[model samples]
Target: MDSEKRNQNYNTYVEAKVPKTKFWQALLKAFVVGGLICCVGQLFYDLYAYWFPTLSEAQLGSAMLSTIIAITAILTGLGIFDWIGAFAGAGSVIPITGFANSIVSPSMEFKKEGIIFGICVKMFSIAGPVIVCGVVGSVLAGLIYLII
Candidate 1:
């Protein structure tokens, strides 16, 4: 009787728990969200290339970079990119420009707190460690390889 009650309790407990996140759902979200971003980027790339056909491949690449930056800035300014970022965490943030949004959004939040410590300093809090550790590790690895 006790075992039967415990089993019933266990089943009820398990049922009450939140369902685990499925890979397919995440994958689908990533695909749809990320692809939408890439599609827009592709359209802009085509537009820029069409508008400036005389530019060399390197120049075109630079122009693409600038155009993407402009688009991201506009999206960030309009408060849409962050919403997209919230929905598509890795999907949105994997792009180079997403990092720009990540950095800028913090700065925007801290704008009222003054420039040095509030805006500039707080802005890089997330990015700072990534940059610092990356550079330091790269330098250390290079030094070790060079010595060996």
Candidate 2:
């Protein structure tokens, strides 16, 4: 048999072995999990506002964001966040906690190679593109606003 024919047969066999995904089941799981995360954030926001009444609205917002980021980093370090991400799919990635997880996961992964090169370098590998895009997108938005 020709090499091309053998490759084609192998590809067909692999395709047959792949499992089918249920769209509705995944969608429901993602919705529930993501909603739960958001609910937790809302709780934190309320708690902070109640506990520190003197804080301005901006301060409370920052506090809530920091709290969520810290919790997500701790979860990522303990290896629980990945499971959440797996179940939540894009739902998990849409939140601020997801950004925290993205940074911490790589840092933990490369910690074994030493802090300077491994942790620091790999830590930003995933987040660098996101930061760049955020800055570029904001600049473009600002330019458009000025033009209008």
Top TM-score hit = 2
Point to the candidate with the largest lDDT.
2
**TM-score to true structure, per model:** 0.72, 0.85
The CA lDDT at 131 in model 1 is 82
lDDT by residue (1-148, candidate 2, tens digit) is 9999999999999999999898899899888988988898889889998998999989988898899999999999888999989988977888898889989999999999899999988998888899999999999999999999
The lowest-lDDT stretch of 10 consecutive residues in candidate 1 is 60-69
Stretches of candidate 2 off by over 4 Å are 1-19
Cα lDDT, model 1, residue 97: 71
> Tens digit of lDDT per residue, candidate 1, span 1-148?
7999999999999988969877787778777888887787778677877998887877876777777777777788889887888777678777767777867788888989999878988898776777899899999999999999
Candidate RMSDs in Å, in order, are: 5.7, 2.6
lDDT of model 2 at residue 7?
100
| Alpha-carbon lDDT, every model | 0.80, 0.91
